[model samples]
Target: MDAAVLITIVVMTALAFDFTNGFHDTANAMATSIATGALRPRAAVALSAVLNLLGAFLSVEVAKTISGGIVDESQISPAVIFGGLAGAILWNLLTWYVGLPSSSSHALFGGLIGAAWISFGADSVHLTKIVEKILLPALAAPLIAGLVGFIATWITYRITRGVPDRLVTKGFRFGQIASASLVSLAHGTNDAQKTMGVITLTLISAGHLSPGSGPPVWVIVSAGTAIALGTYLGGWRITHTLGKGLTKLEAPQGFAAQTSAATVILTSSHLGFALSTTHVCSGGIIGAGLGGRERDVRWSVARRMAVAWVLTVPAAAVVGAIAGKAASLGTGGVIGVAVVGIAVAVGIYLASRRTPVGPAHVVDELYTPAEPTPARKVA
Candidate 1:
């Protein structure tokens, strides 16, 4: 591929991943609100989409981390970045199809690390930076969010115990509007910038920009818009899973979870951590489950989400490694990766259409359990 053409392809792929990141993690901010009837599904996503876009301009600290902190830009090429993005996008799609809200951020990190390692060797992967930035925060943020969620939930119920049910529900539902909006805003700050960083890194590798340069204004706007559009589309499958599958949420619990997750995310962004919004929000939901009056958490669902979380990095890494190896074979190899990625993406979309989940199905699905398949219908 010509240098300009390759860079264009890489930039487009990065934006595609950003689009996936938007819908895949939409549940992190709005799931609980929808579940609690705090906001209509379509309306909630619209608000989140706008906040996500505005949040992108708050700071570029996280973008700086991504562009400079993870993989050594000097040792990698545009092909490697494309491979990494391909892997991340695939993982995001697979998780969405399964109604599992896995971490898009981790998928991105894993894809990049794996592609860089497979293409250029271990030295090209920034081990110290990975530990300091990605792994450490991944381990710590969710736990902290969960703990805060638990505390907040318990307090929410305690204070509201004497209040009338109607007042409590109405009050917290109103509060969810604010809390959920903050979570969306915080999401834009951390997640939108990942794509920005990838584009910046690609520009550096292609010699269009100097090393250590920040993302340009155009890159920021484009990335922000791609993710915002995706957010508006909504990830109803994953939203249903978080809002209704993992736990039964009341308005107060929804408020607590969103507030906790948003606080943690904004703090991380300010400090330049590429935190996973999915993990933190999921943990908050779990915590709220435990703190509820009924304490009716579905451990089975929690276990399934946990399994997905654990698998995200390795699964995405494997795909990225394969894609990276293929891309190393030159133009034909890069073209091959694109073909396979497109095929798989189309397959997943077509499959999802067969039992299409959308805003129309969200609330009804909350009250209805899946029908068990007959022997003849088992896939």
Candidate 2:
């Protein structure tokens, strides 16, 4: 394959992953709103999709972080990046199928590191930048967001304790609409930019763009549109998990969760931390559960989600390493990797048809008795 053709393939694959990121994460922002009836399903996703598209343009800090900071572009070829993206897109789709709200950001990072390490060597990877930009944020963002959500949810109920319960519910249901929309925007600002960064990094490595250059306007537009379209499609499986599985979302809890997640995500974006919206939002959901009452948290589902979180990076990394090795051989190597990626994707899609997790049955089928077991402790 021509290098230009390979670059185009990489860009398209990145966008495809972005689209999955959008729908897979729609639940991260709007699921609570929908569950609490703050907004209708269609209306909520539409609003989120639009705001997500708008949010993509708000900051290039994170994009720069990915394009130049994570790995040395000079050390890895665009083919390696493509293999990495393939790993990411696969993991995202797999998790989405199972309705686990894992971190797409981590998946991407894992894929990139895995591919780079396999193709070049450990020396090609930027460990310090990874620690500063990716690792530290992964450990901190969710905890901080959870604490904020717990406090906010507790306060939301405590202050309204005197008011009629029905009145409070009605009022906060309205408020959740705005809060969830903000979270969606924040999600766009952070999550969508990762794909833009990856695609731009691919271009830079291919020598199509100058080193240290920002993502081009077309990259932004395509990424934004891809994610928005994915959002419009919606991810019912994860939405069911967040909105109803982890805990039943009431109006007040929904409002508090969305508000806390938005604050954490927007703050991280400003600081150029490409934190996972999935992690932050999951923390908010758990916090809402805890804040609603003593021991209200569903430790079981939480455990399962936690396991998924722990495994995501390593799992994606392994797959990326395999693909990157295949891609190292040359043009034939690149085509071989692309073929396997497409084959895996098509196979997953076909298998999904038997027990489809679409918008129609997402809510009803999600949180069913058969979902994975949640973890209780780190050990």
Candidate 3:
């Protein structure tokens, strides 16, 4: 009922969403390294976690875009924001259970937009900014990363041709150490800022901060810590999909993919485009798969991922709208949404245990390619 209490509740929910963002997108940075044996599963996540935390402090421009650019903060309340977060978290959980590396960024944007729009109207949203910043980048970032990854991988294989296989593997595995670390850092730079923006936006809506103000020191630290902790937990299901289900990646290819993803992510962060690290990294992984002479890309797995990507925004938006409508009611509405969210979350967790894919499973799948499939052809 109180504004202060509502703001605190929304802020905590924002952090919880950040934690999901961390583990959900962990595959973007560490999947390939784990697959190629460049780092052990536990060690890879630990390294990525530390880098992600450090990266969160590197930029806040993206946060500014979220807090000020996307939606009209003056027209909405923290209740709408909480509804948006609820929708995003539910989408994130569903995708993770299915091992689909969908865009957590899009889910967040969709939820926020949907909730805000429902709470007020179209006037409450910045249509032009959403198109110019969020939508355009979402469409283009992956294609660009995929192209860069393909070219890089092709050149890597050709340049290292005729070298001893063992030597090539060893050399690139070492390179993967640096490249993957960079990707993890880039992820923190971009993704962590999304949650920061949400929290900052919540605070502003609650009249705790002025419009256009940046996230304070405490906000930044708490967000970074939440995501870092989630990264350590590891999203092995999605990691397995990227590292093993899509294609059988060589050490050199892994190095190229990570490098390409890092380049795109850091560039977008600097420009303050709210890019999806998951899309960029998935594209890079798929591109690297096709770039090799072997052409190990599995079209089926890719097709499935595409379906999930296309559905992320609209699906999350619908759920966000529903939640926002409910939350607009009052305290009882907020309690209802929380109960439903918790029930669904617990259900997904319980369902996932039936077919657990942990670090051990991912490590095992690394060396074993799916049923004898021909090169340069869909499997």
Global local distance difference test of model 3: 0.84
Residue-wise C-alpha lDDT for candidate 1, range 1-379, written one tens digit per residue: 6888788889999999999999987888999999999999989999999999998888875445453457876667787888789889999999998899898988987787788889889888778886786667768877888898899999999988789999999999999889889889878977898789889988988899998888899999999999999898899889989999888898999888888888877777577664678888988888887878888888888888888888887788889889988887888988889899999999999887766777755666443435432222111
Each prediction's Cα lDDT score?
A: 0.84, 0.81, 0.84
Which one wins by TM-score: 1 or 3? 1
Model 3, stretches more than 4 Å misplaced?
A: 60-62, 67-70, 126-130, 210-213, 271-274, 366-379
Q: Identify the leading candidate in terms of TM-score.
A: 1
Q: What is the lDDT of residue 272 in candidate 3?
A: 65
Tell me the lDDT of candidate 1.
Answer: 0.84
Which of the two, 2 or 3, has more TM-score? 3
lDDT of 2: 0.81
The pairs that clash in candidate 1 are: none
Better of 2 and 3 by lDDT: 3
In model 3, what lDDT does residue 14 have? 89
**Cα lDDT for residue 355, model 2?**
55
Which residue pairs collide in model 2, if any? 300-374, 303-374, 303-375, 304-374, 304-375
Clashes of each: 0, 5, 0
